[model samples]
Target: MPVAAFAVVAGVIGAGPVIAAVQGDPALPERTAGQLLADAAQASRSGLKPMSGTVMQTASFGLPGLPEVQGGMGGASPTALLVGSHELKVWYGGESKLRLALPGRMSETDLIVNGDQVWLWESEANKATRVKVDAGAHEKAGGHPKPEEALPTAVTPQQLAQQVLQAAEADTVVSVTNTERVADRAAYQLVLAPKDASSLVKEVKLALDGETFVPLRIQVYAKSSAEPAFEVGFTSVTFSPPAAENFTFTPPAGAKVEEKSLGTLVGEHGADRGEGADPTHGRFEDGELKGKIRTVGDGWTTVAVLPVSERDLRTPDTGGQRGQDAGAIADTILKSAKPISGAWGSGKVIQTKLVSALLTDDGRLLVGAVTPEKLAEAAGRK
Candidate 1:
């Protein structure tokens, strides 16, 4: 997970507009913070009823400027994904049928899951990949996995809200702030603020639909900042089941089609590991991760420590353009990182408004939403 994500266990106009459409706190039936949290949590954990909507995501972590890449299907570029306003069309037909489409300039990318079949289509490349969902894995995941779990894509407000609520423990002060309008629907706003002063996160806000208790929007504010640094929300939505056709995809004629299995799609098969697998990448043993990765501290101040080595920096295809792009991005991150030394040892530290990361000289990477000092302290731990 990204350090920013670890910070909260961790958008827009239209849906990205947040409460921009609201004149003031909307008049709604009173509900205590506890009631709101319980309702939202229940809604999230329960089977998702059929729904479709447009989701918008915006990020302003104050990251250093990154190199720009050409647009099109390539617009899915890693750098472009990190900073900008992006929109996605989502369709949830049931537990076994879902679709997400990311439309770009003259190009569109889509992931469609219908029952046991999954299709990934890239319009610009005129290619499609068909994969069979692992029956056991699909059942274990409760039908279909989330988009983030299956592929790299912007998260919906529902997903982010559940994550924030899970992190709202005794270390957080939870309260019902006021009612707001999101997607033109009156919603109860629940705010969660960290009790830890060292945490860079100021608070997380979730807007739950007044009628259904589903989250319509979620915003994360950084310490000392009034505006949200990251947010994702729905601009428009409907509870009616999406058309069945939306879940089906027939690869365009002449489009290249590749076959794969669920494990192959994620490179999780043991055969893909070859001689050895990187512990930092998460080597599983008997179904649980052991020894390689560990967490320090608790709650909002928690930090994750991962063992690293030169091997982690080497690309599988060092001579390819993909490798060059990866190298450039790494260089940019390193350039922005500051040199630091302490009892934890000397290396580089990257601090953003909401998260901090440390790459130590002795092969360790510690990341969290805490201060650089906190990360260093965790690194010093035996």
Candidate 2:
């Protein structure tokens, strides 16, 4: 879903009282949740305007069972900013991608769809893949089922405000505190606790610009836990209209292209695994796990996966280019693979990385560094 706009923070119990004091009016029109949300949504719709600016985001999360293994998987700790109508630049995945002209290079995770087909560019490997937008598989894969339909012109501040409002509508509250500044504009801060204590998200604090009513920051806390599930922040914003050509793309000559029915790389990757293995059952150590490994373009393939027992999870071996520092990389991956409890209980994909994939016996596809220790821990070895 549109890459959850921002990560939220938890354990903000004292924040409400502190924010109320900063607002300078303890009794200032205690707005009901509904009234406040409506006003925010209205403000957002009215504030729609063409603009452009930069944004810098930093997000960090800990692992599922091993909190000690922190900071393992995200690209760069803090994302650099240089986005606008004509260009969008990002430093991630140990590389950089810049979109300055039509048919230019793009990051592997970058998605560009124009006309009837969607184009995915992997600048690191210098390859591009294409999938028809009207593919029926996209309907099942959570993408725009029909590209021919009229698409929203842009993601406006108003649309963001509406999302926040929808969340607020479910839980009624008596008071909200407005503080903090985003994009050099005033923002409203709200502290909310889930009505149901068992919810995955314990508490959420949102910062919405007072004038524009757009979301500036969001922090999500795991219930009964002081640690945050994830956190995201926004800055350097411009509302200028993007150029028509910004969304279009044309494959380069001699570029290797593959057709897929799914909308996202994750789905495509999963489908590949399913097709290569027996649907009834599969083993982690068997040769069924083997698959073709190639760089997006001309780079050499440098990732692999091997089976490991529970003891292997605790044992660290010195080999290959260590992903960042061991502790940091472990933390990043764990946090992204937070656990889920239910019938379908499979963990969620917090973030996708450009690396190798591991198909486990239990139907889990672990992606990223395929180190013995990393895979062991991810596969619940210990």
TM-score of each: 0.75, 0.43
Name the 10 consecutive residues with the lowest summed lDDT in model 1: 11-20
Looking at candidate 2, what is the lDDT of residue 272? 32
Clash count for candidate 2 is 36
Query: Candidate 1: how large is its RMSD?
Result: 7.9
Model 1: per-residue Cα lDDT at residue 58: 87
Report the lDDT tens digits of candidate 1 across residue range 194-240: 77788898888777788777778888899967888888888998988
- lDDT of each prediction vs. the true structure? 0.67, 0.39
* TM-score, cand. 1: 0.75
The top-ranked prediction according to lDDT is: 1
Candidate 2: list runs displaced more than 4 Å: 1-22, 25-32, 40-108, 135-175, 193-203, 221-229, 252-254, 263-266, 270-382
Off by over 4 Å in 1: 1-26, 68-75, 134-170, 252-254, 257-260, 265-290, 309-322
